[model samples]
Target: MPVRDILQLGHPLLRAVAEPVADPSAPAIANLVTDLTDTVAHWRDTTGYGRAIAAPQIGELQRVILLRLPGRPVWPLINPSIIAHSPEKLVVWDACLSFLSIFMQVERYEWIRVRYQDQQGQWHEAHAGREDDLAELLQHEIDHLDGILSLDRMVDVKSLCSREEFERQFKANSPYGR
Candidate 1:
């Protein structure tokens, strides 16, 4: 599978809620999971910063996301939902594969409880906290499924900056982690 073109901020598809997958085991969905995983991997290899990506980012109107976390397997979450979130919030300089040239400072939940399914159609749930990168990543990608962007959740619109300016002014706020 090839890396699909990631839609930009203004694209109408990005604003539309993705439809839930009816059959997680279907070949089409399986292929989408593969494409998404490959795309994020390709992004990390090229830009050196990527953790998760949603199907909508690639112009696919499906409720699916692929996550690649450190010390874990690369997996796809079908119809993922945030069942719970902590009251605490963290200021994060969030970026997306869809908009690689920009970054935004947005407040995200310090932790979240999520329910999702694997490609095999197995359901799983977990609590992802700030102890790892999943907290920020989950919020970002889940937002994509609901047609929300980091720009929408930004605590400070002035926090928006291009990659160059972000690197120069807020290098310490790098969202990337090992």
Candidate 2:
């Protein structure tokens, strides 16, 4: 599979809710996972950021996302949803492959439990908490599947800043920088 172009922040498709994958093991879904993996890898290499990407980011209207933690292989989540989440919220800075130039501070669950299907169509549930980063990362990608962006989750209007500004003015205080 080839790396597909990512839909930018203003693309209408980015705002449209993605459809659920009818068959997790379908050939097309497998190919989509490959493309998402390849695309996110390429972006991460180029920008030194981007840990995951959603199908909708590549203009595919499907509820799918590929996550690649540092020094780890790509993991695909099909028809993923947050089955439960902690009542506690954490404020975190988020950036997206679709709009890497901007960084926003958003509030996400401190812990989450997600249910999803693997490429083999096997169902599984995973839990993530603050230390793992997956708590917010999964929330971010899942939001894309629902036509939401980090900008939509902004803690405050003042929380939006350019990447350069974030680095210059706030990196030292950011968890990502620490």
Candidate 3:
């Protein structure tokens, strides 16, 4: 298990669409999945907030994602693709580990259906609806598989904020704050 270095914006690899995992049983792919899981877990333990991560963000050109839901075991999705999406949309603030400082508001489907493979090379499909951050996180990571970054999805570049600034603004705008 390893914590891979995250590729940053402007890296050509981040813009290239990832290739589908041809052999899920490959030892290298399996090792990557383990590394991704460890990386996500390490981030969550240190910062208390990561829920999902993508392969491109780690410099890998593979359609892989690792998700760890609260109270649930780590879920590995190999060759994940969004097969369906709802017309209804929602704007949410998101931050990427690759772009650690920037937070952006990107629009995403309120519901989505995705098809993917598990660690054991078995196929599976799942539906996610306005069910908390899981759906949003899933879409965010899947976008990475397709070479799409949250910055590209931003409605306005000016709306982007640094993590510190976002926290300050949120506090200032909160009702409890004088």
The candidate that wins on TM-score is: 2
Clashing pairs in 1: none
lDDT of 1 by residue, 1-178 (tens): 9987788879999999999999999999989988998888888888887788999999899999998876789978999999999989989888877787888889999999999998888899988887666888888999999999888998887888898887788866465634
lDDT of 3 by residue, 1-178 (tens): 7788778888999889999999898999989988898888887778655778898878889989998777888888998888999999988777788787777888888889999998778999999886656678899899898888888888778879887887777524421122
lDDT (10s digit) by residue, model 2, range 58-134: 99999999998886778999999999999999999998888989998999999999999999889999998976488
Please report, as a residue range, the 10-residue window in candidate 1 with the lowest summed lDDT: 169-178
The lDDT of each candidate is 0.87, 0.90, 0.82
Name the runs in model 3 displaced over 4 angstroms: 171-178
RMSD (CA, angstroms), candidate 1: 1.4
* Candidate 1 Cα outliers beyond 4 Å, as residue runs: none
Q: How accurate is candidate 2 locally (lDDT)?
A: 0.90
Error of 3 at 27 (Å): 1.6
